[model samples]
Target chain A: MWLYFLKRLGLAVAVVAIVIAALFAMIHAIPGDPARVALGPRASEELVAAFRERIGLDQPILVQMGNFYVSLLRGDLGRDAVSGEPVLRILLSQLPDTLYLVLGSILVAVVPGVFLGTLAARHRGSLIDRVTSVISVSVMSIPAFVIAIYLLLIFSIELQWFPAIGAGEGVLDRLHRLVLPSLALGLAWIGYVARILRASILEEMNEPHVRTARAFGLSENRIMYDYVLRIAILPTITVLGIGVGHMLSGAVFAEIVFARPGIGKLVFDAIISRNYPVVTGAVLLTTIFFVLVNLLADLVIAWLDPRVRHDLAG
Target chain B: MTRNTALSIRDLSISYDTPEGRLRAIREVSFDVARGGITGLVGESGCGKSTLMSAILGLLDGAAIVESGEIWLGETDLLTLSRGEMRRLLGDRIGAVFQDPMRSLNPVLTIGRQMTDIQFRHRLSRRTKRERAIEMLHKVRIPDPAARLDRYPHELSGGMRQRVAIAMALMAEPDLLVADEPTTALDATLEMRTIELLRELQQEIGCAIVFITHHLGVVSELCDDTVIMYAGEVVEAGPTRALFEAPRHPYTDLLFACDPARIRERSRHLPTIPGTVPGLIDVPPGCVFAERCPERFAPCGRLHPRPLRVRGSEAVRCHLHDPEVTS
Candidate 1:
């Protein structure tokens, strides 16, 4: 099992390396002058040229990539285009906010989503199942931005429940302001999770072990939780792992709509200003985070299901 | 001795609400299994044999509704107990071993955990439960119970898993054990070993066993009394020796004739029961086996025959077996 994980880790590292290279090349390939953008539109030609030389923009693309990789290995993510501050420092400061939002939304989505999904499966064709199905489908069908805008309008503009723009002062305050955006993101995910889990549970509930559990005189709750849910929810864990990256991407759009001072807004500003260093750092950090989350999920799945470990070992 | 009846059923009818409508699976099924005796419930597939077992165990699904019945296990009517009460009694006093041992045991749990869980449910101390689990495993004659306890269900072979399941069922020392086609999925040697294990366990535990199967050879070998069910009803029932020697019901006679051993002994072509068992949804009004019985008469198509006592020790549900009838 450890050997299999090591192999997977190797493959993941290769994939991430390829992704970083591609992202670096693509960002630089855009028809624009990074030095001109950095020095501002009003800067003299000499000033722009001097800025380009300082940043090694005149070097060959391969040489520049080599330099970037070397600096990346040394934990130096270059300088921000506008502030000339270390891009790594700025990213480290903003990392927590993105992590908080993504993790919170996932927690809010997974618990209730799985619970409702299991309930729907166990009482399939019942009124509760029908109602949950309709609600989840409706939530999923609507676009996230639309939900975010609607929530903003309701809570910020009309109800005066939360601030209209910017993350609030303290951690609790930031979380309070984040409630609408997280829900906006989580609403769509809850529907998807519930749908997947419902299908899985329905399939598992028909399995003979479930029948055996019932025959053993296990209560409905015990059988559902212990036998049915344990097996059925395995697929959901894998899906959740894959969905983490998507959720982070969604958080970008959500932050923009809510005007929260997080990584999403930082990325938007950097993209507009052509801050290549910040962009590269943000993308790399997100990729690494995703890979790490997936690795953790894999470990969790192995722990929950011994068969997976056996299969891996075999 | 009279008080030793472990399971007594009377006029039990079970039906399910399917898409087509209400379908009767078993009708007026009645039988009694005395304590410490193995009662073999024998029938072909779709003959309501399994339905009868599920009904008696109170394990029928949501769709099935018991129309009328009394499933008395000791002083308690199992049919009347609340789901909680039934659950408490089940696996403690009444154990069950299902067909397809691969599916019966929880794939995620170890054999030891499965056994100890039942013991735990009955509120046995953890240490005692653990010791009893190993003891039960030994009782099933599983080699190296201590080492095998840690192995998951998939690690063991099919026959070994079946033995583990049986051991788990007997962990609580239940008074009645239901073996539902316990050896059907096993090879011949494994099947014999499983039967031997069951008989030995029964001898040690002194438990009443309801062994449900289609194989008459198994019934002849292990059962003291046998009930031959046909199309949701008992067509013939009596002492195993008497019923096997002189099967009065034509369906029973045809079943015996169809056996390969019997056909070889008679040195004749195997007699096959013509036509399939009728669908439960539209069971015939008269005799369920009338369409398949070669000796069936016109009256067999119009009137359902009640089980009549024949020759003191046997009961045959046929017009021909009625003492008043001369035919």
Candidate 2:
């Protein structure tokens, strides 16, 4: 197990390295001069040239990439081109809010989603199943921004339940402000997670072990929760891990709608200002996080079923 | 004749509702197991043997409905028990071991965990449960039983797993143990070993066992009484030795004659009962075996044969066995 963990970690590092390299290449490939964008359209050509040199844009792409790589190894993500703030510092400041929103959204999605899915699965072919299936499917089919806007209009503008814009301060205030955005982001995912879980659980419910459990006189609750859920949750974990990547992207729409400060908003603003360092830094961080989550999911599944672990070993 | 009945099923008829029509899975099947006796229920696949087991266990499929029946476990009619009462009775008063040890146990749980969970409803202490689990494993002759506590079902070989299943079924020391073809998936040697183990355990535990199988050898070797089913009906039943000596029903007679072990010389082609077991929806109203019964007469197609006592403690569902001699 230790060897497997180490091997996975090593492979993750290699993947992240390639991702970072690709992000660098892709960002540079876009037709734009960061220095020129930072300088106004009315700025003089000489000032622009000096600005380019000051930011090391005058160097060759290969040299710049090597310097960037070295500095990244040293834990420096460079300065934002327009704002001149350290990209890493800006990201660090934004990281907590994003983490809170993402984690909260995940909680929002998984709890009720799993509950509804379980309910639907248990009462399969009944009215409850049909209703939940329709509701979840509808939620999934609609766009995230549309859901966010509706939430804003109903909760903020009409009901006066929450503030519509910006991430608020302090622990309690931050959570209070996150409610709308989390719901907006999570509602759609709830439907997806619920659907997958319902399918997985229904399949597991039919397994021969379930009959064995029943023959042992285990209650339906024990059978469903203790036995069936353990097997069914494997696929759900994989989906939820993949959901992390989706959450990050969805947070962009959520942040944009709420005008909140997080990685999503950070990336959005950086792109508008042509802040290459901040954009590249945020994307790479998200990618690394995504890879780690998927790895965690794999480990979890292997832990659940020894057969899978044996397969992995061989 | 005065032997105590452990589990007696009477007038049990089960049918499955489908889009096409209602299919009778088991048709007024009646049988009884003597206390501490192994009663063999044997038939070809799809002859309602499994359905009978499920009905006894109260684990029938969603589509199935018990049209009429009483499954008497001692004084209690099992079909009349509430769901909770039934749940309490299962694994406490009645335990089960199924075929295919590979699929019978929860793959994700350790053997110890699965056994402990079975004991949990009794509210035994964790330590006591663990000890009981190890003790049961030992009874099944699993070597290093204590160490095997942490192993998953798949980690054990097929024979070892089946033994574990048997051990689990015997763990609660129930009055009845329903084993549904428990050795069908095993090799011949392993099958015999398992049957021996089961017989020994039966002696030690003294639970009435409903041993379902298609193996006549198993019936002869392990069962005290044998019930032969053909197309969801009990065609013949008697003491194992008596029935084998002289089968009254033609199907039973044909089944015995077709036994490969009974063949003196190796033949290129083996004898088989011609025609298939009829589909549940297509079963003829008269004798279910009439289509394939070589001894069928004019009256065979027109009337369902009732049980007729052929001799002491032996009966056959055939017109030929009738005292009036309708055939």
Candidate 3:
């Protein structure tokens, strides 16, 4: 199993390198002069040229990419376009906000999602099950932005349950301000997790081991929660990691719709302004984070479910 | 229900609600598993053996309806017990091992955990439960029982998993143990060894076992009593030797005839019962095997013959064995 994780780690490293390379090439593919795009049209020609030279745009594309890779390896994210500060420092400032939002949304999705899923599976084919199915499907059918708009309309605009815009202050302030955005971002994923967990629970309940459990006279609660749920929760765990990774990379809708100062918003602002250093650093960090998270999820699942190790090893 | 019997299944009828319609799966099946003995419930595929076992364990799905029945374990009617009541009776008074040992034990759980988990019905400490688990594993002849405890089900071979399953089932020292074709997925040697293990365990534990299988050889070789099922009905039931020797039901006789050992001359084709068992959806009011029976007489086609008591504790549900109908 350790060997399996070792191989996965190797694979994740390759994936990170590949993602960084692809994003670098994609940035280079942008049609306009990045220096002019950064300094804007009114800036002096000499300033644009100086900016291009500073970013190594005069160098060959391969050399430029090699430079980026080297600097990335050395933990240098280069300078911000306007502030002349390290891109890494700016991202470090933004990381906690994004982490809080993303992780908080995951909690929002999972706690209710797993609870509803368990309830649905326990009372499958009943009125409660039907209601849960309808709710989850309806939520899943709507896109994140639309859900965001609706939540803002109800909770922010009308009810004033939470402030609509900006990622807020410190720990409690950020958590308080995050409530709506987290809901908007995670509502659909809650449906996804619920559906996955419900199907898994239903499947687990009918398994031969479950029958054996029932025959041994395990209480229905113990059978459902302990025996069945332990196995059923595996698929949900994998899905959760993927969802969290996606959200971390850019909960673009949530970050933008709420005008939050999250990593996603920072990346979005950088991309729009052609802040090459910030964009590359933010994208690379996000890719590495996503890959590492997925690797961790796989290892956790393999630990919990030995049957998964065969597939993991392969 | 009788004092000598560990499980008494009386006039039990069960059905399943399918998309097509409600289909009768078990039709008034009756039998008694005597204490400290193995009773083999033999039948072909889809003949309600599994359904009956599920009913006995109260593990049937929502679609399954026990239309009428009484499963008596001791003086208490299991059918009358609530879910909680049945649960309390499970590991303490009854145990079960299913077919496909690959699926019978939870793949994620250690053998030790599963073994101890079943003993949750007991008021013993965790240490006592672990000790009992090791003891049961040893009884099933699993090598290095203590070390094997930490191994998960997937780590064990099919035979070893089945052994672990048996050991786990017997930890509570249940009064009755239901083996539902537990050896069906094993190789011939493993199957033989498992049957021997069951026999030795039954003798030692003094627990009645209702061994459900389709293997005639298994029944004849190991079971003290045999019940032959046709479709969803019990066609013949008695002491294994008596039933094998003077099997009165035409279905039982035909089943024995279909065995490969009975064929003296070498042939390219093997003997088979000519027709398939009828679907339970629209059962006819006649012998379940009448369509396939060569000796099916006048009354066989028109009337359903109840099991006729031909000898002491022996019965056959065939017109040939029904003297009034035959006469």
Q: What is the C-alpha lDDT of each candidate?
A: 0.84, 0.89, 0.87
* Candidate 1 regions with alpha-carbon error over 4 angstroms: A28-31, A41-71, A168-170, B261-272, B323-326
Candidate 2 on B271-313: residue-level lDDT in tens?
Answer: 8989877778867878999999899987789888998777833
Please name the candidate that would achieve the greatest DockQ relative to the true structure. Answer: 3
Q: lDDT-based ranking, best first?
A: 2, 3, 1
- TM-score of chain A, model number 2: 0.95
Model 3 residue runs over 4 Å out of place are A310-314
C-alpha lDDT (0 to 100) for residue B66 of candidate 2: 95
Location of the lowest summed lDDT over 10 successive residues in candidate 2 chain B: B307-316
Candidates, DockQ: 0.56, 0.78, 0.82
TM-score for candidate 3: 0.96
**Per-prediction TM-score, chain A only?**
0.95, 0.95, 0.95
- Each candidate's fnat, listed in order, reads 0.52, 0.72, 0.84
TM-scores of the candidates in the order shown:
0.92, 0.96, 0.96
Model 1 DockQ reads 0.56
Model 2 regions lying over 4 Å from their true place: A59-63, B1-3, B323-327
Q: Who is ahead in TM-score, 1 or 2?
A: 2
Over A215-268, each residue of candidate 1 has an lDDT whose tens digit, in order, gives 677778877787778878888889889888887898899888888777877888
